[model samples]
Target: MNFFLETLRFIGLCLYYTLEYIFLLFIPVRKKNVAGEIVLITGSGSGIGRLMALKFARLGATLVLWDINGEGNKETARLARKIGAIRVHNYACDCSKRQEIYRVADQVKKEVGDVSILINNAGIVTGNRFLEAPDLLIEKTVEVNTMSNFWTVKAFLPAMLAANHGHLVTIASMAGLVGSNGLADYCASKFGAVGFAESLMLEMAVQGKTGVKTTIVCPYFINTGMFDGCKTKWPSLLPVLEPEYVAERIVSGVLRNDIYILMPRSLYFLYALKSIFSTKAFIPAAEYLGLFTVMDTFRGHTKKAEDKHQKTGTKTPRSLN
Candidate 1:
């Protein structure tokens, strides 16, 4: 009876803390002016990245846009300038390459200023089954999604450490927290990203670097062409998030120096439930409830599309998971 009471107390305490955190997250805090802050964003050419870039730019930040696509990079810069950015610099570089990232870092420091914020947002997904996925695709996915964070952090974190003030934001995914079929490579990469971000946070805490904040964002599918045909069985429960909504949340989270930013907020409780329940019970229950089937259908559709493209002489556009 004592143990049961203690467990109840613990659960109640956790619930109280979670509710408090959610309230704080929903209420935006006014931030100090970022007029002179220099911000670098990877994959700033499109989707959530583009929206984030605009958000920062509107706040009078000096923007540095990086994308492998030169045209998109240029367009982002133009938009940032139009949005009232104090300064805008666009670069076309493959973030997956360490040398390229280093080169860009050097140029950014010289051309712009010491980066006050770094958003490691570049990512790619090949919607192929695990076994059917080519080795190169897997390597590239890991390189772009996971290893790029390592390179970007190494290159830019030194300045932040020296200044004793900075923000590091990593745009991870829901796949990192929960596995899904047809997203083996994507899941692996995002999981690595989450691990890396968590470890970095621990290191920062151990070092007593409170001024330097790190935020890891795990959001579900966005309304971008990347996850073109993806569908959820319970659309009302797990609706597709808008890129603008995600961008707004990310901007607000960073300003608040939040440690973990989970979109839709309800997932925090779901994650806790998963942690407390036994896999034998939870897995079968989730499967019977159609959670597994929803993801399986999404994966199967992508696989079928890939197979069809392979049979025909046409290439399918890449889709984000």
Candidate 2:
């Protein structure tokens, strides 16, 4: 009888949420103010990370930027300052190293105070067939993409829990939800990120820290130089997103306290199909969508830099994220 009652309660709650979501489609969500709030964004040197920094900066948030490349990080800080960020601090911290992340985190706490918004945006991709990839690169991928999130959260979550107010944003990828070719390690790390964000959300809610928010973003191939030469099967269906557009969307989601932000909106159905259909049933559909060949010409940012160096006769520096 207790189990039956629980089942009915779950059904009613599901229905209530479903209807609430539908209603919200017509109504605009109230965006929370982050003016004067401290926002720390990792991998803020380039691409989406850099754009997100500018977004938060323009909104009057104090920005703490981190990246392995001091030059690029400083450049991003300069740009943020120009964009009206009065208090922008840039740190050159290698996210792959746990100790480095912890040390820099301590510096941030001392210099900038507790971070109100933590965006775990540091990530890397090998873009190689699993077996064709080097062992070191595989380990690097996991370290930067997954382990960094674990450490950064540990560094800041305590303060959020104590105050019962903060936002945790993880920039994951659509590949995390559905695996594709030539991204085995990348997929593993992003999948881990999705799980970690969801679990953290549950943990916070269960512990009555409802004021601490968590948002997991899973975007398709973005035009952010990170996925430089990657192509989409269907441009209309899965268009490659621009960095500015992606950053704005992320800021909007954070303000609204959205749990997940899967771009193009069509992916919501594809994810559902994956959940409802068997593996074999999903494969044909994925193939039909050109998911299998999306990465056929995958030449990541690193390779592009390397090629540019070869042509220009100057050594290209590698980024930590």
Candidate 3:
């Protein structure tokens, strides 16, 4: 009798949540206020990380920015403060190092406060055919893109869980949801991030910490120098996104407490198709979409920067973030 009763309750709750999701699709999600909230952003030196810091700063959130490059991190800090961020803290910590992440996280907690918003936005891409890619770059990619998430979550999730209120955001990639050529390591890392975020969401739910929110953002190639020489085969279908637009979408998704935020909206359909279609069907679709040859001309951030520097005979920043 108890089993039957519990099953009925579960079914009813499922229907309720399903209807609520549909309702939310038509109505605008209420944007939560982050004023006075402490927000931590990794890879905050450049690309999406730096963009997000500026947006959060404008929104009145205290910013804690971390990057491996001290000068670039300080540059972001200066920009954030200029954007009206009342409290902006900058730390030079290598995300690929477990101890460094923990040490910096501890310092942030002591210097700033508990991080109400944690955005694990640090990522790297080899953009080379798997065999051609350097072994060391592959290892560093995994260390930074996958393991860093674990360390940062460990450092901040406890406080969020204790308060039963906080937001965890992962800046994954469309490569995470769909496999592509020349991005084996990158895809692996992103897939790990997606899985980590999903599992954490389930864990939070099981612990009855409903107030702690998790949002996983999966976006396609953006105009940032990270993917400098890459091209989209289907410009209309999968355009290279603008950094500002991508950054804005991330902030909006976090504000709305969205669980999975896939940019281009069309990606939702593609992901669904992948789940529904067999290998034969998905393979043709993937080919037509040009996923296999997307990285043929890949000259990544540092490479492109170095090329320009050599041509111009001038030095410039070269790190991804």
Candidate 4:
């Protein structure tokens, strides 16, 4: 096409999408029906994962729950069934292992059929400073929070591509978009998760797979026991989020096909500032917001609880699934 025509078309589309965004602010988008859709959730044993599963169950979707904790996963499945999930399947699969993800994914395909929605919510945090953190724990964090997303998507995306209908949800963190002190490893992993999800979304669009959707969640610290003793500097401005609230927002976002769901609303402005302000300017703002000292009291899980979990081969009671 000629340059003039192409430029005019581009400007027209920009205005069209801008108007759509403004219009939708006051008029809520209709949520899509999820009844009978198969939804798979990793780390479904506890925290936001379990909460999301229950919500989906109530929406009449079949639930496939995966977690390293067999007992905990079973409990989640039981609760899902109790809450009205007609077909609830629980699998004790360690998401940190690529082979395990593939193996369990194959089983899910044969046993439960194609999953229409996939939530990569399994994650772990060492809650240690960069220097003090153990090397193994750092690796484990990356394997679970980042690499596992790659494996899970590869396992199920092909089916979604063929059918051109699927939803991919990434349960990342605000740390993914902006770095925080005392979370070097954790931040790295979540950053990778956010990047991977964004790239996947672009790839789907490039492939003309409009039916396949993606939702990337970047919420501030949630009170899911993962950040046990961590406190917000300004409770009113950036209060620690509740797992129930986060889970509800996530499901709602996915149903509406919203691409990015940053919690607490305030996060939207903070993330926007990251792009507009210089690094030096942003650092002070972040510090004043308590990003630097937020993890000073982050005691992830007590040693006693961890020991009990190790002995019983179950999940740490305080850990977020």
The TM-score leader among the candidates is: 2
Sorted by TM-score, highest first, which candidate order results? Answer: 2, 4, 3, 1
**Model 4, which residues run further than 4 Å from truth?**
1-8, 302-321
Which of candidates 2 and 3 reaches a greater TM-score?
A: 2
- Please give the distance, in angstroms, between residue 74's alpha carbon in candidate 3 and its true position after superposition: 1.5
> Would you give me the overall lDDT of model 2?
0.91
Question: Candidate 2, which segments miss by more than 4 Å at Cα?
Answer: 312-321
TM-score between candidate 4 and the true structure: 0.93
Which window of ten consecutive residues has the lowest lDDT sum in model 3? 312-321
Give candidate 4's total backbone clashes: 0
Cα shift from native, residue 256, model 4 (Å): 0.3
Q: What is the C-alpha lDDT of each candidate?
A: 0.83, 0.91, 0.90, 0.92
lDDT of 3 by residue, 207-244 (tens): 99999999999999998888877888888888899999
Better of 1 and 2 by TM-score: 2
Question: What are the per-residue Cα lDDT tens digits for candidate 2 across 1-321?
Answer: 699999999999999999999999999988999999899999999999999999999899999999988998999999998877799999999999999999999999999999989999998998888998888888998898888999999999999999999999999999879888788999999999899989999998889999999999999988887887888888898889988899999999999999999997888988988888887887798788887877788888889988888898877544333
Residues 58-112, model 4: lDDT tens digits: 9999999999989889999999888777899999999999999999999999999
Residue 197 deviation, candidate 2, in Å? 1.1
Tens digits of per-residue lDDT for model 1 on 1-321?
Answer: 699999999999999988987787687666656667888999998889999999999888888899987898888888888767758889998998999999989998888889989999988877667898777779988999999999999999988888888888999998888777778899999999999999998888898888789999999888766776677656666778998899999997887777888876766776677788887777774664345654443533345567788888677644332
Please state the error at residue 279 of candidate 1 in Å. Answer: 1.4
TM-score, one value per model: 0.85, 0.96, 0.92, 0.93
Itemize residue pairs with steric clashes in candidate 3: none
